[model samples]
Target: MTRQLRTGFLLALQFFSVIPVKKQLPMEKEYITAMYAILPLLGLLFGSVLTSTVWLLRDTTEISSLLLGFIVVLIGLVLTGGLHMDGLADTGDAYFSYQDRDKRLAIMGDPRIGAFGAMALVVAIVGKIILVAESINEASLVWVLLIPVFSRIGLLALFSFTKSAKPDGVAAFFQKRVSHKKLQLVAIVALVISFMLLIWSATFLSAIVLIILLFGFSWLYRAWCLRNFSGVTGDLLGAYVEGVEILLWMSLLFFV
Candidate 1:
């Protein structure tokens, strides 16, 4: 059990981020399920890196908040290797194509980027930088740490509740291996932990509102994916992570 859990963490790190994991890990059912279960922890790791970066920049340098925000955003792109951003681009391209479901999926599978994809990437990146710049201050560093954590919690919820759009691909393969009950339990525990952190750093009311918004957006996004793609795909899941992070950051502008 310990070995599976450890390998699962490594697997999640390897597949989701730019972290180096040289040893090839087993991709068995238990390990893959464990990988999905550990996703929020992965988000926590990312949050820590981001929080640390903010601290280092603010404490050690005289950089402006706007530049600090841009650096933080750049670090995120570096950390994930823009994996989710690619998904966001693909999703934007496919959705705006105004094609049928099959055609949209085909566009997503293509390696080439379209004008819509480029536009989506620009808006998302610029929006994230501006929002982070506006939202972060000395009192609200906790919000920075919690934003990715909640966005990932949203990811788990979306994956648990939605069906894969196709019979093949990374999303479908992992979806088959996951135990929805176990994944839900993981998400619940992560949510509880996140709430505790939020309450410690901010108001209980704020915590409640953030969670509500997270899940509500996830529900709505699930419906949107269903309407457009018939179900979730790997690309759509990536799009959710990017979309939800932006939403969480934007929400902090209100409460934090």
Candidate 2:
């Protein structure tokens, strides 16, 4: 169990971020797929990175909370190497171009940023900064800390449950390589963790609210994927993560 966990953790670090793993670590695709279980933990790590900035600077007279919050979000971007954000950009450009589905996929494959992509990037970045700051100011550190954790779980759920649009790219590789049993177990674990976090931070009612909304959103996103690109892609997954992360923050402000 220890060795399996270590292997999964190492693979999680390799896949989710640009962090350098130990030279002794193996890069097994099976481990990479199994590593989905660790995404929530990886998110906890990320949440710590962003929240530590607030905790460290909260007592400072010169550093404004707003600035600290922005710094935290910026640090998050750096931590992840902006990989998901890039996907979000590409997804926005591709999905909103109103072209044929094939052309849209082709657009996402391109390195260039379109107008829609630029707009989506601005919204996501700004929304993250603002909502993060608000949550901090609200002293909702628990929610902030768990937001990434839940978002990662959300990402894993999307990857596991949805069909790959074109059976191409990294998303396809993950879908194909991950075994069903492992995927189901990991997703269930993540869902259980999500419920625990929500219940810990808020009332059971609030937790139930979130649970219901996520199911609804998941169905909607799946439908959108079917209509737009025939199925989900890495970019769409990233977009879902960002969208859900911010929505989770906002939802807690009212529901929690």
RMSD of each: 1.1, 2.2
**81-141: candidate 1 lDDT, tens digit per residue:** 8999999999999999999999999999999999999999999999999988877664377
Q: Model 1: runs farther than 4 Å from truth?
A: none
Instruction: Give all candidates' CA lDDT scores.
Output: 0.88, 0.79
Q: Each prediction's TM-score against the native? A: 0.97, 0.90
Q: Per-residue CA lDDT of candidate 2, range 172-223, in tens?
A: 8777767756766776777787688768876889888877767777778878
Error of 2 at 115 (Å): 1.4
Candidate 2 Cα errors over 4 Å, as ranges:
22-29, 59-63
Pick by lDDT: which candidate is best? 1
- Show how many residue pairs clash in every candidate, following the order shown: 0, 0
> Clashing residue pairs, candidate 1?
none
